[model samples]
Target: MFSDLDEQLASTLRHRAGGDIDPTPIVTRARARGRRLALRRRGLIAGGVAAACVALTSVVLAIPGIRGTDDRVVPATALLLPQAQSGAPVRPGEVGADPATVHFSTDPLVSDAEYATWRSGRGIESVEFRGPSGGSRFALARTEVLLNELQQTLSSAGRPQPRSDVRVGDRPGVAWFDRSGDRQLWFVRWQPAAGLWAQLDTYATSRDEAAGTASRVRFDGAHRCVVPFRLGSLPPGGRLLECSVTFGRSAPGSFIEGALVVGDDSGRWLTVRAQVAPNGSEARRGDLVAGPYRARRQGSDVLEMVVMPCVVEAFRKGWGDGYTEAEGLAILGGYQPAADLDRPDTW
Candidate 1:
């Protein structure tokens, strides 16, 4: 009996000393419990934020500028901190306004898809004026773009003709013409400001016409509106990287399509667009419903939300970015039209 007691006591001491304890399972269980606690904490925080948004939205909707029609409740995004920074206001001779009402090619020279790809690569801003045959292309550029025009022309397959220093009104600039197949390409590069320049291009056109068109470009930088929508509750660590907003032109002027883009630190993006659809076309393609909004998942990473003429799209980086289906709905629910739809937008 004494020997049996000694054996039992020795076993107890070994057990107490953790000699037989399997630490791997204990560590794993502890880790799992910690993860659960963390998830619960995050859920509570999100819930609190959602409640606050609801309370704030009530007060925001009452504001006169943000009031919406009966069918559309104003979006709740107007009350958030601004993510867009103001830039220099549009001055005279900006790319949008031109003194001469010159006609451009009616045919599209570059497809929208092609332009989007090229523009993204160049990191430049431009406007595409589409016509029946071909459209004109205008861009705001730096002086280096002007200086390198000759080299860029030579690099192309087109045979470059004589290059000349020309004057557009009071400003001196460079002009060059190139022959490619049956088309004659005219390019006029001129300075609109001390450090800023503008490039105008046309096919089968004249240097004078291009220069005249370039002179009339006007930009008004004042009066940009904020994106009225934000993520109702942002994904963890989400932050704004870049944003662009444009307002559609009112009637009596050519229909100007508008767009908004918001990029985040998560390598994701949100885009909003307002454009005319052909009569008798369907607007809502999304079957998923977020309140009154219709939303749909496009492919694996994109969430598309349709609001009548305007379509908003959100992109995800990866699963860890936390932009789940529920989060996507919350973002769509946060959208509201800007109070000043007629005002100039930050692009």
Candidate 2:
């Protein structure tokens, strides 16, 4: 029943897919080189995609998550550093506004330098303490929480929906969203074993009008901190899981059709083609599974490393560094690490 619909949808996407295909060979070769470069880099690092940052921030803020406190929250500078020689609390909000002053804890699980670099690029303006509900206390920027709130809202509105289990670098996560609409967005959150707070957001605005408006707000937003990740810390033999929903523009450009891809680091890949039936049912048409593909790493340092060529390519194409880790892991699907790889199971 769905085969006919699948073929129709595939035919509709043929042009876009074909254009996308033309770059595959070149991308494959570049990805091979990128992988080797990433391995040589030897530490998990984040990249900087200037354009994507703007889009991501806008989408995150627009969603319904948390509206950060404007005046009540205390900045990171106000908090006493664990090893500070002086007992005095630094003036609140002062240090946070200066990229140079914001520092990630020097714990082995966290990279101060990487955090600093991310803060410098993002221009973080303030840090706020959220909760100590029980024994857990989180120190996230007011903006970060705000973005999370936006994502939650979008998720609640059913604009962007969760699809499957996946990994961002070595961290486990889930993927969601529909493309081809005015607002196309996806997100993944990686909770590290080291007990640090971090998250990744990937969003796209295909409509020119929405893109223009979102771009303005995103660029003008106050918070600009980049979340940091430790890719090299992943267990050498760890596996990656990836699931994606691809959207295609409908005839006359009225709507988008989507498909699903589920793959794992164990070298298994599955593609489930889907379409919205006239009755509003999500019709699954065809399925394809293949695998045992090799994975690649890129970059010379943690500050520049790129894992997962496909994701890197997307970032380079304009997705931004923030999404690179998640995109790479998604591209790799099931990426099994070598025996030498070792990542801790618990934070």
Which candidate achieves the best lDDT against the true structure? Answer: 1
Candidate 2 wrongly placed segments (more than 4 Å): 1-147, 150-158, 178-183, 204-347
lDDT by residue (tens digit), candidate 1, 1-347: 21123224444544684553323223222322333344346446665211101101111122222222112233322221122233354433332232111111111233211111011102234444322233345656444554354222111235667878878778898888776456666777777667566676666467777677666654333222234344444445643332333211111111122333434555655444333222222454667876567777655655666553334555543212445667666666666644433332311
Tens-place lDDT digits, model 2, residues 172-218:
54545444245464444433333222333334332232222222211
In candidate 2, clashing pairs total 26
CA lDDT of each prediction against the hidden true structure:
0.41, 0.26
Q: Give the TM-score of candidate 2.
A: 0.20
Worst 10 residues of 1 by lDDT: 112-121
Cα lDDT, model 2, residue 5: 31
